[model samples]
Target: MRPTILRNIAASVGLLILIAVGYVCFWPVPVEPVSWQAFVPPGYVGPHAANTRLSNINLIEIGDEFGPEHIAIGKDGRLYAAMTSGDILSMDLDGTDQTIFANTGGRVLGFDFDASGRMIAADAMKGLLAIDPDGKVTVLADRVSADDPISYANSVVVTLNGMVYFTQSSTRFDPRKWGGTLDAGILDIIEQSATGRVLAYDPATGNTEVVARGFSFANGLALGSDQQNLFVNETGRYRIWRVDASARNIDVQASSSQARVLLDNVPGYPDNLLRGFDGRIWVGLFRPRNPAADSLSEWPFLRKILLRLPRSLLPTGKPYGHVFAINEDGDVLDDLQDPSGLYPETTGATETADRLFIHSLHARRIGWVPY
Candidate 1:
């Protein structure tokens, strides 16, 4: 009787193991991961060498608000920050006189001021929005057609000629339905669908048209000093692209003189691109590359299996804070890093004559360091 009972217990444990294996192997996941070779991460070396330069940043408290994702100095000489609560807050450079400028009722990832001083916002859930000086909000473009709507509007740049260019991050995973911006982005990147796009909106005719497509996750937009070239961040693939501003409906994947990768195989996941002082474009490395993710990149089935695990087991961005400035030639000019990662997600920096205001995705206060 004792022998029989021990055998039954062993059998039960074996059955449980089989069930777990089957679930991990066959369970459906949202991402249909594509097989691609991930470049071996260039560890902190050369221009991107490790440093403690960003360790001593000062904070600009925003009271109860958090996640000051994108910031810009408005034409009125005040700093405008788009918070996670959908409130656009205006404050003095010293973090004083903070006031709610406008609320778009959607998560705004990036925004820029137009020639008319209206804030053009790339709201992740609400599409392209324009907020007037008096705080009236308007939806400029939400859909390309009745059937195709903009899923993730991100990073906007208003040219001097009144053309508003913005990035639509992923067509497959909507942030609203898939938790939020960061989660949706993870799904899209893991899937490698390259559904991201660049679009142009003409306020004159209320018409929006596609500029370029075929980015894994098209983020961050900045116009060249000539106003003829647009610098775009393709986040998932760890690169930046320089696309001709006039190129219409161009596929970045196909060989085209219209779009070319300017920076390739950077050490980390690049986020926003801000054109800063003296022809330097500032870029933030949101997270360092995960070797496990890279190793699975060429194995689509394994990637799917990996996603079947618990959400907590999935690889996420580390807290390491890093941001850098680059020239048009793709040379790293300044690299600031906080290995301790005390400042959270440093998206990029807004450079004034004297300070570099660091942006973050989850920090309660805006960080700054002397320029």
Candidate 2:
């Protein structure tokens, strides 16, 4: 073969191989089998009679040194928090000097612990990330829409098989535009596409599947104590939906299986959810969907037109902080409001021995709130 011809042939072969590998690496691998449910709970007014308010609430302002999003309290009585700006920090019960434990170079949101005590985070800009005590970072679920680089990791919880059930708060919004679209409320969903769902991330096989879909804005995720179903909080719809992770091997029929809502309108929009040792679910609230926002949500056709404009030209809404205490049955028990109103609403919660730690994405801090 001529020298130039040989070189051209070699280059063509390399390009073909690259294209093949790229296709496999970046494909929307559909859900293996989905459990589907279309039931939504009736709009709730307030806490049910069976649920009671949590008292003796105490707050600790862990300054800008350690900004937090979601919180996790390990077995060692130490609290770990995912910071929105770029790092995860550890703090003591008395709001002591917080220390940076993990630096993922992305906004950290939801997190949970594995059997081995490794810290897993639902990073907003990045996908799922795991951090060991030494601060080693690992990418568990690197992308939601793998081929598209569509990432919006939110809240995460671990199962026995080291699998993770998590949420991607909004598919229409990514970290690049988070600051511009963070609190769009119901209007965003009405204006944009409804792209929210719960996902199953298997570490052993390095696989991620969308187990449930059709949510307004999926935010928090948690497994029932019995492990019967994985619950996801759809912020825009103002409800929580349950998915049957066990049915993945069975069937993917429309009516065969369903992801049902546990509770809706717990007096405020639920941001992140956690099941406590006592059977109650601790949820972080970004804020109640401003009724005005909800009213505006009904006009998506018009809002959709506005979103196409430059972000700087849009009217960004205000931000605030809120928390909710709900029981195992999905009933709101008490409302945790920000009396000080210094920082924006919270994302996750952690319980340290006698204290409760919270992550404030809008405020730069990491610390505890008296339970």
Candidate 3:
């Protein structure tokens, strides 16, 4: 009787093990990872060397709202910030008399002011939007056609010619269906399908055209001082690209003179690009590079397995505050680092004469440091 009982127990243990193995091997996941070579992360050295520069940030409380993803000073000189709550709040530079400017009802990751004082916004879930000065919201371009819609509209810049250029972070992963921008972005990066593209919309003609295509995860955009080149942050590959604004439907993957990598092998995931005063472009490193994620880039199967594991076990971006400024020549001009990451998800900086307003993706308060 004892021998029979022990055999039954052993069989039960073996069955449990088999079930676990099967789950790990074939369980469906949202991301279908693609194999790609990851660049070796350059440890915080050179211009990005570890420092306490961003450690002392002054906070401006926004009470209950969080994730000030992008901030732009309007023509009226009031600071406009796109919050996570879908409310664009306008306030004084010192954070006084804050009031709701407009609510797009969709997340606006980045925005720019047009020549006519309209706020051109890149809405992640709703596509490109235009908010007039009187707090009226309008959809500029949601889809090129019924079959081909903008999946994830990201950053925007309106040229002097009334041409609106924005980025579609991924054509494969829709943010609304995948549970917001960050989650969808992670899935797209893991998949590495490189469906991100740069598009231009002519406000006069109400037409949209592709300026450039083929990026792993395009995050940010900043028109150059000359307004001829568009600086794009390709987040998945940790690099910044300088693409010609005039190039139509240029594939960045192919050997094209229309586009070139500006900053390569960044130490962290680049988030937003803000052109500052005097030809300086500020870039926010959302999170420091994860060595484990980089290692799994070449092992697509392992990445899939990793995703199948518990969310706690999956490799994720560590909270580290890092932002820097670069010139058009790809030279690092200023670097700020906060290893403690207390200020959280520094998306980028908006530079003024006296202060540098830091943007974040998950902070209740806006941070700023003396310029």
Candidate 4:
């Protein structure tokens, strides 16, 4: 009925599309996408097949204290959990006598007990922390160097000698500003900046130094029983690495002989490492790898374009409970799974004498299954 009007409308729409395309293509995002070689993840099968063993876990409700990402048994023979509310919860084995042990005012994704009965935590906002029995919290190490500080402090391990080793999940995304740990992790993974690193803190010397660098997202750290090596989870690459405990000022990925890949092509984003009853290392696969994300990994331009879009529109992986027991040599002993995702985002599992306590990043309660 109106050809001229229809032409004008069409031109306007075309111009808008052009502008949108240009913005997406040339956006100056913080991430400088790296062209990484990502392989297709293995389907849930064989030793790592799907199961519902962790489906009907007994939950210890934390009320509003949510997101218990890591758990450890304290010297008092009680359960202690690091929660999203920046509080460490202590309770009996049956979830009784619940008490707020201490609040770090920072998110603690992982923690371990030192020989002195102090709980050493790797906090996302405050860096390494030590909480004594009297609820006293001390900031151990917040920065590696003035230029390259620890941005995303993650999982930590304390040796019997009191040396602390921890992971910096991302140097680019600070969890305090970029949202929580998950949000910051998404940005780091999408950017592929390889800024993740590992560091060591000597309590006696009051010094901190970088142990390794050049990981996409170094997520977790676990010291071997021999105390000679450290197992680290590289969440962005779906691999677990073994770094020499004595490694000093080395880049585990770029140059260096002290570190080696212990496990490769893992089924999902390896989240944390926990020492089991018999030197078995328990690892939680936070979520299965996203097919779309992997497919775009080789194409840095596509990743950049993806980053330009709203994070809500991005293809993120759905939650599925999965954990595996492994040895120091990367040998998988067993896999526990809940394919239906009854309990989502199983980050790691702490094995006690009688039960297994599961950690989560989203669930409102801590899950436990009989050992």
The sequence of per-residue lDDT tens digits that candidate 3 reaches over residues 289-308 is: 99999998888888888878
Candidate 2 is scored at a TM of 0.75
Greater TM-score among 2 and 3 belongs to 3
Q: Where in model 2 is the C-alpha error above 4 Å?
A: 1-45, 48-63, 144-150, 177-192, 247-256, 305-321
Instruction: State in Å the error of residue 293, model 1.
Output: 1.1
Positional deviation of 144 in candidate 3, in angstroms?
Answer: 1.9
User: Which structure is stronger by TM-score: 1 or 4?
Assistant: 1
lDDT of 4 by residue, 1-371 (tens): 59999999999999999999999999687677888889888878778877888777899888888888999898889999988889999999999999999999989988888887899889999999899998899998888767766778999998888888999998889998887888889889988888888899999998898888888899978899999899999999999999998988787657578989999999898998999977689999899988888999889888889878987878778878888899998989878888777787989989999898998998898999998
TM-scores vs. true structure, each candidate: 0.98, 0.75, 0.98, 0.97
The clash tally of candidate 4 reads: 0
Candidate 1 weakest ten by summed lDDT: 310-319
RMSD of every candidate to native, in Å, equals: 1.1, 13.6, 1.0, 1.3
* Model 1 deviation from the true structure expressed as Cα RMSD, one decimal place: 1.1
| Best prediction by lDDT | 3
Candidate 2: give its CA RMSD in angstroms.
Answer: 13.6
lDDT values, one for every candidate: 0.92, 0.64, 0.93, 0.88
The regions of model 1 sitting more than 4 angstroms off are: none
Residues 1-371, model 2: lDDT tens digits: 89999999999999999986665454332212122222333233445322222223355565565456677776455677766557777776575766788888887778888888888888777788888878899887766554834367778889876778887666666655645336433333544355676777888877777777666677888887777678777765567766787644222213445555677555456678877657667787665454544444445343444444455544433454556667767766665555344556666565545666665656654545566
Lowest-lDDT window of 10 residues in candidate 2?
29-38
List the pairs of residues colliding in candidate 3.
Answer: none
Give the runs in model 3 whose Cα sits over 4 Å from its true position: none
- Candidate 1 — which pairs collide? none
Best-to-worst order by TM-score is: 3, 1, 4, 2
